[model samples]
Target: MLIFGAAVARDRAWDVAVELAERVGAPVWAAPASERAPFPEDHPLYVGGLPFATGPLAERLRGHDLAVIIGAPVFRYYPYVAGPYLPDGLRLLHITDDPAEAARAPVGDSLVSSAGVAMQMLVGALRRDRREPEALTPQEHRMAPHPPTDATAADAVMSARQLFATLRSACEADTVLVEESPSNLADLHAEWPITEPDSFYTFASGGLGWNLPASVGIALAESDSGRRRAVVAIIGDGSFQYSVQSIWTAAQHGLDILFVVPRNGEYAILKAFAELEDTPGVPGLDIPGIDFVALATAYGCHGVRASTPAEVAAEVAAARDRSGPTLLEVAINAAVPSLL
Candidate 1:
């Protein structure tokens, strides 16, 4: 199996990674928490992102005898899950541009080189192997979409799955997605298929307060380059507060960026961590009474609220035709996900 990281796309080697995967007849898994789409998610060889912990990642790659990891750390983990990094007898070769990334890995043989150069060299040196590409039959390889929820109730809040499915259907194929909603990561990844290069971006280190401002910059660049692809940012309510002032910049400059805030009235990601760590009854996890639409209006951007799928579709369509940035806050169910 082959694995790719953010640097593979960052260094403009997406095509090379795809070519190399095709040459080796291996399926590709984007490294855990990868910020960019190194390989097209629509490709047959693409198996989606890996798990974020040691044991789960190893178990996910169980049948693979040798794994070639490119342009990423050997592994990036969270919650301090204790287990072996790789399964017994499974060999790994880590290739990356940063020496620090190569040095700190707990397992695997490391090589430091430019991601594009190393992959190009490998493409020339390695012949296409005869091994039949293995089938990815289990749920770990790709997350199946959740069944669509009924959005008919007068005051019912949509689940994250429903919201993502609605957005996926409404969004354009070439739309650039800037995502920072950690709690909704699984649903969003399963629903939204990123088919084009440079169309999806997130913070590799999972930092807060970066994506909102970064979306502004991306929209500005899009306008200047004459490629006016719609830029939509999916930010959690907790993360939206970290750099809420940045929306003012987007408004002042008239950048056409759409900020979709999933208002669940809590820090869902932190709650998930607390559960994983067995530290329950944590105080101050629920955050209530924050008016995101009002805050957007205060920042001089158009603001609205959507509670159902139809409303969400209408609001997104209207935002696209608007001249400036808009913020659409959607009410979503507050189900905390198991992050393993």
Candidate 2:
């Protein structure tokens, strides 16, 4: 099995990774909390992302006897979930550029080198006599289903899953997706397909306030390079407020970026953490009545509110023709996702 992490994409080693995987016909998993996706989500060998805790990860890797992890540590974990780091009879080979990361890992033998160079060398060294793994079974490329329109008034709002499905349908295949909506991330990952290298980004630290500015910089880089891939940042309302001022820079520079805000009117991520930590009754978690449209307009961006599925799709499609930055605040149903 092959496991990928951020540095693989950072080093632009995805082509070599694809070659290696195809040569070996290995099953691949995106490491948990990976900031950059190193492999195409549509690849047949691709399974999905791994869980971010020890017990859950071990259980996921139970059937695999050998794991080859590239461009990351043996594993990056959170919440101190207690369990064995690796299942019995499983061995890991870790390849990373950072020697410190290799040394710090509790499991796995390490190889320190540039990701691209190392993968190329591995591809050259593999014996020609090795048999390719059996072909992957065909699977349908279906996204999450849309919400039923005939629901009760209480269930009238668009769900996070529906919002992501709309985004997946509206966004271009080459669009660069920068994500920071923590609570709804699982839904986005489930719905959106990262089909190309360098097409997705996120904060590995899992902190707030970086995504907005970082997206502006990404748009700037695209301008400088003249590659001009569409930059789309999906941010939560609460986190958007942290560095909302960055939109001004995008506006001033005339960067063509689309900022999609899923407004649930609360710090939904914090609420999820509160539940996980068994700490309820958390005060100041609800942040309602923030006019994101006015705030975006004040920053000199084209602002619009999308409350329905059709409006969301139309706004996203309309954003492609915008000359400067556009902020589409989508009012979605409130739901705290499980952290694990």
| Number of backbone-clashing residue pairs for each candidate, in the order shown | 0, 0
What overall lDDT goes with each candidate model? Answer: 0.84, 0.83
The collision pairs in model 1 are none
Residues 42-137, candidate 1, lDDT per residue (tens digit)? 787887778778878888889879999998887877667777889988999999999999889888899999888999999989876644566654
| Highest lDDT model number | 1
What lDDT is obtained when candidate 2 is compared to the true structure? 0.83
Instruction: Give lDDT: candidate 2, residue 308.
Output: 81
Task: Write down the TM-score of every candidate.
Answer: 0.93, 0.91
Model 2, residue 230: distance off in Å is 1.2
- For candidate 2, write residues 1-340 as lDDT tens digits: 8888888899898888988888888887777778888888788787777777898889878988999998887787765568999999999999999989988999889999888888999999987654577665422221111112221214658887788888888888789999898877767876787878888888885778888899999999999999999999999999998899999999999999999999889998898778878998799999999999999999999999987879988998899987999999988888776676
